[model samples]
Target: MASIVFAPADLVVATSDDIKVRFAGADLAAELPAHVQAPPGAVGVRVMVSGVRGPETMQRDSGFESARLAWYQQRQDGGPAREGSAPTMPGMLVLERVGALLRDDVGTECPSVAGQVGGDGTEWKGSWTYLPHPPEAARTL
Candidate 1:
């Protein structure tokens, strides 16, 4: 199964209806297994997060805060192409909700996201877990 990691900086918590995530391998379908392929026929995709600290512990604990990101898979028509051309890749990823990173209760809204094949396409099912980055140590110069 192909895996992608989203660092704290790579996640974007936009407005209520928008959330952006920039991680490696989003377009690595060719390299991933059939389930995780970027093509139309692929298996389910799972998205999750780690290193979540409760809102009350945000100030007391030196760990990262809680955060969530939800999404659904969809199929879009690629339109007509040359007979010898490649099939159009699906271009639909519907976000259900984005947790507030700044809030103590980010986990309240964000749920684990799992995406299955959009239509009759085959799929390569895999996990997409998002864990918090380790804090950098201070330099003692």
Candidate 2:
């Protein structure tokens, strides 16, 4: 009864134990070393992309609340402390990079990135969704 979140591109990461196989959160736990087990409720998966990958699953009560908090602080602080952040977690910025950041004002100025690579190279583009407030009373949408 666990839910999953998949990245548009694949991801690669390691585990506490050493086992050689593509790593995902729910589907591939059995293939992992005996020590790999999902917390009480979760799944398994694996994805390898762009020199970055990791297990892809989330928990209902995970520290997501804290994640947004840190993101807010970082965004407001403007990354002034790039060298050191107080208590870092892996998935902290991911929520902003993907689906969640699509609606934010960050991309207001769409810079013309392509058309001038000069060698037919592809430019990278991205968007995210942001809802910085608490769900209002959980009423019908």
Which stretches of model 2 miss by more than 4 angstroms?
Answer: 1-14, 17-57, 70-87, 91-141
What local lDDT does model 1 show for residue 84? 31
Number of clashes in every candidate structure? 11, 25
Query: What lDDT is obtained when candidate 2 is compared to the true structure?
Result: 0.28
lDDT leader: 2
Q: How does each model score on TM-score?
A: 0.18, 0.18
> How much lDDT does each candidate structure score?
0.26, 0.28
Per-residue lDDT tens digits for candidate 1, residues 34-135, read 443244543232343222223432332222111101111111233333223333212112222332221012232222233332122221112342222112
lDDT of 2 by residue, 1-141 (tens): 132344434333322122112223222121222343334433222212121333342231145446647766886787744445454333323321222111113323212111111011111112211122113232211
At residue 59, what lDDT does model 1 achieve?
36
